[model samples]
Target: MTILSNNSQVTYSGTGRRKKSIARVKLTPGSGKLIINGLPGETYLQFSPNYLRISYSPLHILGLSNEYDIYIKTEGGGLTGQANAIRLGIARALCTINPENRTALKSEGFLTRDGRVKERKKYGLRKARKAPQYSKR
Candidate 1:
């Protein structure tokens, strides 16, 4: 993704994806308050603590979790996918603030985009690869 905005304010903006989820992330200097889809991050992702942890890992890794506010508008997938996508978005946005951050994010594998997705089912198959058993008669 690319920086959608930058200047004196609105420090950075970036997009991130995982599976089918897409996250639009905005980074600003402030007390770390993460908001998702207009809801507080903790409230929006309360389904699992893991979701919170995954989405916050990048900031935690950089030791800037409390220095920047993260706002995410994510859609197109389940909570797990959205969480991961947001994680990537945060890492990428951080890169804009400091190019050196790329090394740390890359070293931590946060910059690598996951390419695995659900396989399409073939005609006559029960699922992606399962097939019906033939009758011997």
Candidate 2:
């Protein structure tokens, strides 16, 4: 986590990863607004309520959704992965803002980094584990 001060306003930042996605998030005191990669969060996420909801769940959980602005730069994954990464990043930044927020975030499982990822495909198999069709005929 890092802190940046611009015009005397403090910004809290955090990085989060999920699968192949990485999200760098900044939290600043402002009306609730979400911006991702220079675009409105909803527009960038294709207006999918699910994605928006997932990305903002941490703040909503703490009843702080309207207290901060979320700015994020995310890349390298599908929407689901990116949304999750953003959620984790937001949770982490909130923790930095207030150490006391950690317990609440953790209890809600927002602080946990999901470790599941795509399994590597084997040399002679389809996908990660599907085998070729039998040749008994």
| Model 2, residue 135: C-alpha shift (Å) | 1.5
lDDT by residue for model 2 (7-100), tens: 8788999989999999999999999999999999999999999999999999988999899999999999899999999999999999999999
The superposed Cα distance between candidate 2 and the true structure at residue 61, in angstroms, equals 0.8
TM-score of 1: 0.91
Per-residue CA lDDT of candidate 1, range 24-53, in tens? 999888999999999999999985789999
Each prediction's RMSD over C-alphas, in Å, is 2.4, 1.0
Pairs clashing within candidate 2: none
Model 1 alpha-carbon drift over 4 Å, by segment: 1-8
Question: Going through the candidates in order, what is the number of backbone clashes in each?
Answer: 0, 0
Residue 83, candidate 2: Cα error in Å is: 0.2
Model 2 earns a TM-score of 0.96
Query: Candidate 2: where is the Cα deviation over 4 Å?
Result: none
lDDT measured at residue 42 in model 2 versus the true structure, 0 to 100: 91
